[model samples]
Target: MTNTFSPLATYDRDAVRHWTYGTASTQVPIPPPTGSPYLSDLSFVSGANGWGPVERDSSNGEQAAGDGQPITIRGTAYTKGLGVHAAADVAFYLGGNCTRLTATVGIDDEVAPYGSVTFALVADGRTLTTTPVLTGDSTAVPLDVDVSGVQDLHLVVQDGGDGNAHDHADWADARLTCAQ
Candidate 1:
């Protein structure tokens, strides 16, 4: 069966901004504004561990090289896929006049044994949504958060108590919509 999604937000794609953690070093250049639907890529850092670009799906061996494309849903675009290193916990600082945010989190499919991970959306120390657990076999966990009027939004993914054996966690189709 195929997955379908309702459009999440409406805005001028040309006005959207973009940025990536550290540097824009992924295999695929970050999609242009016309193709993007949000602000910058948000800075990312894993808790004392390493981080890397989200790999292409299993089609590309899920290698730690290229940046994945935005997962479009019902005509709306989402965040490009991103991943972090093993045993690592990572967060993205999505700073803007965010009204709504949505995305999916899960382990990259190419990893062997496919470890576990958790996805959390946080704003001003308040916990918005924390997924139960995601693995290779698990469908991407959906995150739809009401961040209206929020100035700072944080998207975090961490190891799921399994020591990050194959913890290539991905922030798939992640996105933030701001007020006009």
Candidate 2:
């Protein structure tokens, strides 16, 4: 037996916006030809985010690296106050389970001068292996961490250096895709 219902709708080809940062930015929705088109109101927040500036052993710079970059979701930094990291809203759910996460960024002057976009896998609200921090120099630092056994996976953000603050992360957009 087959049942019929209204079909899922797709946004206008030019309706949805894209944002990004760091280098080779092509995802963020810059000042629109008319108005703001970069804002999102999608449901489902794949997050375990929390951030606060503090003096690590060396009261120098901040963290813009792994797990750190993705957690920053402040809109005041943007032209229209759309949050600092653009990728905080964009996400994908797939395979009846896994929810893939992706992010893109655009650099500006307000960002910390030294840091890297950090990604971490959290299980049962516990700390896991802290992988080597990823620097802005590396783009699209993707993680294939199996979410099949996780209920909470977090992506944090911060800077990188020999305990010195020099780099910054001007984020723009975030997107997600998965195959469940």
Candidate 3:
């Protein structure tokens, strides 16, 4: 579908914000002019990850972007999804044309038995759904959030209380159902 998004006052496509934990900073890329049901097909408006850059269809690895393995949570592998580190917020402009957002979120198996994180789905500025603290050993949390009339959607992953050491998170098979 065509992207009908016009930049809101809060969203600056060229702005960059630095993180407190480390030297890593958020890089805001220009949002795609077109939209797709699959989130991986659309570019993020703004976001940052603790480790490497946010990867598409793969898990966050120790090296560079797109160097991650298949997105796996609790032994289940996903072919399509987003791989991000904790303290990450990936946003997409919906233009109030989307109906729903669905995904199975969890810590990637790459850091199994280790990392901890929390997943939250935000529509516009309000939180729609949030998962409990999820560890590498925890099962994937399924999310189906109503996003109708929402202009922006954010997939946020935060470090669970402790520090963000091994917090590799995944949004498996993430898909958005939008109006045609």
Candidate 4:
């Protein structure tokens, strides 16, 4: 058997870090900033929460299905996104000083109606990268943002004003790198 569980990234002097939300079993509550309402079916978990990459039209309580392990680096399977619910947020910290952050954002291959969600990276109240709209797993949104002298970052995925309908998002190959 393979050890599918691992941290988002393995740290080193180069000050590299990664974020794979569902790799571990830590469940953190994600409340909206202030006026935004809470999105449903979003949380942290390990493995495929028995969800494939398809979102249903009706509200049968099946939001977390389409997300599972994504491509892995080295030998570790990547973690799922933080939402079974439409919108999800995760707190990120870098182990070492870094100048840039990069990642690929998309809805899991197991989910459907991908156009109903949008993934973004928000840092210090600025929207760094926001995908127009995802329709399927065929495409992954690539985001590279300048994080020089920055401390905190927020990974967010939101329902596209469609009331969280079939919104299963994922952030893959998330990495923080320093200027070399």
**Best candidate according to lDDT:** 3
TM-score of 2: 0.33
- Candidate order, lDDT descending: 3, 1, 4, 2
lDDT of 3 by residue, 1-180 (tens): 233333323333458643333233344444432333678878787778888899999999975977999999999999999999998999888877778788999999999999999999888799998899999889898988888888888899999999999999999999988766
What is the C-alpha local distance difference test score of each model?
A: 0.53, 0.32, 0.85, 0.49
**TM-score against native, each model:** 0.57, 0.33, 0.80, 0.52
lDDT of 4 by residue, 29-147 (tens): 33222221111222222222223322222121343453334432223334422333356665454323466766666555555434366777766667777888665544666777776
Q: Specify the poorest-scoring 10-residue window by lDDT in model 4.
A: 32-41
Better of 2 and 4 by TM-score: 4
* Residue 22 shift from truth in candidate 1, angstroms: 26
Model 4 regions lying over 4 Å from their true place = 1-85, 113-115
Off by over 4 Å in 1: 1-79, 86-96
Clashes of each: 3, 51, 0, 13
lDDT of each residue in 83-113, candidate 2, tens digit only: 2231222221222233443334322233433
